[model samples]
Target: MNMNKKELPSLLLLPGLLCNERLWQNQVNNLVDICQPFVADFSQDDSIEAMARRVLDRAPEQFFLAGLSMGGYVAFEIMRQAPERVTRLALFDTMARLDEPERAATRKGLLRLAEEGRFIGVTPRLLPNLIHKDKLNTPVADEVMKMAAELGKEVFLKQQTAILNRSDSIPTLSKIKQPTIIVVGEDDKLTPPEESVNMAKAIPNAQLHRIPKCGHLPPLEYPQLTTELLRDWILQEA
Candidate 1:
């Protein structure tokens, strides 16, 4: 390990459903100078509480925290569980609310498919909801699908169950005291920019950034831009 790396703050990154460290590969590689990046494994746990506990158990005493989509839900749980242990918070393409009726129905449908052993991760039909139209045929889409495929069906079932049963985090937003940043893609269909807008409004002193021509997965859709956003947030003064 580099001596400078040991001196930097640890950035604990949480990936969304059907995602792994690959989702944060760019951030981890690019932010090495400013922070030690650690991507939490959400594969073992089936509930947000358990997932948050897993992260807290492995996390440094005090670290910067960031989560995307389903990972954002776990971040909220982490804040609820150990806010004092966190130095900063960053949420990307996520919301503070529980699954709406329509969204719940969609998740249930997918869950049913997986249960019947018909799980096809990130299919061509679902690419539009997960990435920008321009990224549909690009390497970005391939990376997203690869992450989903590698995680496989069992992890998908666990992640979806956790997402479906996650708590409503709206009330917990105002209690966040750490310097926070909320980011969303302008064309994100899954969570939308408005969700990030509301989160920014709720968390005191939280900053919100909207990336144009992006979708649900900004870290993959716009890795450099995401890295820079995270760099600025991590380097922000007290």
Candidate 2:
């Protein structure tokens, strides 16, 4: 789709767990000319499905959508509700299956920590798992920490609870007909490259791209690669 200067598609971006609007600022800066992007407030709703509905309610009549981690879960629900309204889709560092038993235990533990006012303790430990090991002591780490702090304990718990109970969407992926892009960080221990690969395989037309030397949050750690992949995917879809 070679859109003229004024014919760009609007994009709805979803942030991950314990994240805020800052996560997608780099993406917006990089794609503003080709896409008008809006960040979804997934923190407001308690359930993944409800959050998806709320986001879709405020989205353009039809638009391109991209989501990361927890956001991907909500995006899948949005796709389920309004497949026709979506012109293209992007899923990054996320999974299609619901939380597994071990993962649920992990989420439950995190929630318990949050409920006990130990959210700060959890953040330090959790943040490292979301970014590259080398970035653990850098400015990027500070930025992730800042975003998590900005999200606050109350909202973090809500996001975690919503994720714990999110529905399985693997079966629904194949039903989607829009152009799709699935990206993963080669070092992403949280979602893992295998999970993202499986999702790409399930979605008939999805293209999978893995970023090297990065972890779960590629937009923050490797903004240029993320933007390039997304821009290319958007151009291909058009």
TM-score of each: 0.97, 0.94
Cα lDDT, model 2, residue 24: 86
Best by TM-score: 1
- Per-residue lDDT, model 1, residue 145, is 90
For residues 1-238, write the lDDT of model 1, one tens digit per residue: 2234668899999999999999999999999888889999999989999999999888888899999999999999999999999999999999999878998999999999999999999888899999999999999989989999999999999999999999999999999999999999999999989889999999999999999999999999999999999999999896
Clash counts for all predictions: 0, 1
Question: Lowest summed-lDDT stretch of 10 residues in model 1?
Answer: 1-10
For residues 152-185, write the lDDT of model 2, one tens digit per residue: 8888888888998888998898898899999999
lDDT of 2: 0.86
What lDDT score belongs to each candidate, Candidate 1 first?
0.93, 0.86
Give the lDDT of residue 49 in candidate 1.
98
TM-score computed on alpha carbons, candidate 2: 0.94
RMSD of candidate 2 to the truth, in angstroms, is 2.8
Query: Residue 36 lDDT in model 1?
Result: 87
